[model samples]
Target: MKRTIPPLLTAAALAAGCGTVSTSASSGGGEDAVTVESCGRDVTVDGVPERVVSMHPSLTELLVQLGVGDRVVAQAQDALGEPSPELAAEVDAITSISADVPPTREDLLAQSPDFVISGTEYEFSAEQGFAGYEDLEKAGAPAYVATAGCIDRRSEGAVADTFTDLENLGRIFGVEDRASELVTQAEQDLAEIEEIIGDDDPVRAVQVYVEGGKLYAIGGAVEIDVLRLGGGENLFAGDSRFDDFFAAEVNPEVVVDLQPDAFVFAVNDAAHEEQTRAYLEQTLADTPAVRNGLLVAVDNTYVQPGTLSAITGARIVAEALHG
Candidate 1:
């Protein structure tokens, strides 16, 4: 069953003056000479981007992390609006592309952005009817897609590949130093976690993202990497992407067959936490995870692919499994 959860409202306030971006050059070289890959295409950014637009929240967060939030002139519709207290102030100056739609070409062109950043190809596809990078080329604006979410699988090496993309972004944004530091920190964090958990005994676990009473199983290399990093085994070893499974497909009898020792619930709001917990308790009462009370709740944001997966995500899972 697939349940649609309402869009989450962020309590964070938008940063003041996000809408009045200035084209004046900074003290240093503008992002004009910078070049970044967008949807597998190389885009040359002439100078430091004076006017920028971001299509995804994850990409927006990445820009901020790189210390270039002030360069952003506009943002996508759902991408704007504060989602958390930490991000509230940054979102203030941004203009919404539309009530609920991604930024249109006219909206983007009006902003006069030198470059645009997106976390995935879906952002471009959903916003522009154009097939690929051609639309961005025609618009005279460079676009970049975070490579973390573009992997063929979510395996350990794939996870490392995603991390490499973060480094690539840092290089493009003139923050190569910071990006390297972050990658080093993330690697150390993962190593420390693995050391603490040790390879002695791995726990069998399954990630269950519940929204609107529907249960979806996450597969692929990325999901598996997360489970392994937490020192757990993924119950579903399929080749399909993350997909939904109905009650019948889940098969009550399969619970015993898979024998997951724990269940991870990904949710957006606190209200649904208890509701999902109760539903899972009732539905899988006979399962080992339920009997042992190993149900855990995680932020939906972290579970989604992006830079946070290497930073906040690793910490969240480490604390859950070890602390």
Candidate 2:
């Protein structure tokens, strides 16, 4: 199915008045106003933000990967998934203001943060105690959403956008140098696989997520693009067989017919992972991917757009399909 750029980021452009960006202390500083347009709003970062609050896991994880998690004093506990051991320490120290819901306005105000980072637009609803970005600006705390995390829920989660978000954060925090280092490292990690798989024919595959006996395919461009970059061809990309790219339920018959060479399973926990494996093995036993033992299990974060997850996930897919 064809899709348009989300209205939030439709033809959005970045304008840094000074015409120069610094990787070191050259943040959105000086007399010139730093301009960034996100989800349909133009944001002028008047100054660097010190005290920051992250409202979702992806934002927190990004900060952690960028070496700035220590600065995020508070966040949504539920959104924060299992992290690396070192990040666990950092996450443990921060205040968990909400369990499964966005922190109320009072909760946000209590933090006294200088900047706010939200994962989804839904988090900014009045019900979540956020009157949205304008309210945050009025409260004197400017905020930003990860490029892929805008109002569009077409379910697009892209790693490239994660880098963009990181660059934006670095500009807002005077840490562009650190962001560059992380991006460079990610590029290097991904480059190794690209070199090895360049000659291999692309593998046809359909990645899916499993939850409570239900199967959902992964079709977001952010994720699909990575598959392409990793040297795998997404069978569902304009295959015309899929009626809805965002369909919540999967038809095993479709998988059996497509006969994808790989079955990429995105699971969050051991139980879900085991269930997905069993379902595929029992129902798709005769399928090419299953018969050939090409089932790949990856963390849900792998499809959720984080620096480490994206690089790691792509490498996993490449090794599974090409190696």
Candidate 3:
């Protein structure tokens, strides 16, 4: 996967002058330590941050799962309206910062957040137009980028990459034990899924992310790796990365050309789900998947790279394939 540069540093630099420090005795009887390497920067935060700002819904969800949702003071504007019922209560206390527009230094300063957690570094770099790494350093609040959104193909060492991220978050929040428990459960769940599907005939499937009336086929390393765990074959296994395909990509003449036995649609919103369902119903009318009514709709977040992909996503695929 190609990596994109983030814009956080620019804004961080401009907000650089403020410094507020508070100290607390460590429960371990040593100096309280909260240090993390995120977005290529080593950040040592002092004590558990009382006020945290999550710049993406994914981060918000992760924090909530880690039992730190109560600390979040602000969230991205895009995440403000009508969250899933499961997340609505936590979001009620979160103030909105428009991610499409760079958050002003004043806006961030007013939140009095000691830490900022972004879903992707690119959200700060490309979307928010931050200047450089120092920008975050200057803001008196350390910023941590979610590794799940890290585009570094080289750093994705193993399935452990996802587990390590959970541990990293635990370290940041002084809840390392809780993080470990979640990672252990997640790993066990994935392992059980693998055992259940062991030796089964691989079901050929295709995952299409729909946006703006177009279908983008997911492939290359990510989907293939995940599908293999779910005991299924990615129909686009030969492709190296995700690619946008046209009507021609949907060949109708050769039955084998329409190879997938199941279809998964990654829908971004409720409206997108309706649009995708309509598009698939019309275009894939003759495909075995559609003819057999085996279309599956998945949340956009689950299909995208994330910590939840291994367990939650694998379970979804296993059930779909088994069904």
- Highest-scoring model, TM-score: 2
- For candidate 2, report its TM-score: 0.78
Model 1 ranges off by over 4 Å: 1-32, 76-110, 126-132, 151-157, 238-256
User: What clash count goes with each model?
Assistant: 22, 2, 13
lDDT tens readout by residue for model 2, 1-323? 11121211211211112112111111243574565655555565667666788875546777887777778888863332344445667665777887545677788878887778875455555533454565677666666666765544324556677777778777777789999988888888878989868799999888776555556665654567567667788777765433333323567786788888888876545765788899999888878899898898765555553345666678878888887
How does each model score on lDDT? 0.55, 0.64, 0.57
How well is each residue in 12-107 modelled by candidate 3, as lDDT tens digits? 221232322112112221267677666455667777888988775556767887899889888763321234457657755666765433355557
Worst 10 residues of 3 by lDDT: 1-10
Off by over 4 Å in 3: 1-31, 77-88, 99-110, 126-132, 154-160, 195-198, 220-226, 240-258
Instruction: Output the better candidate (2/3) by TM-score.
Output: 2
Could you tell me the lDDT of residue 4 within candidate 2? 23
RMSD in angstroms, all models? 8.6, 8.1, 8.1
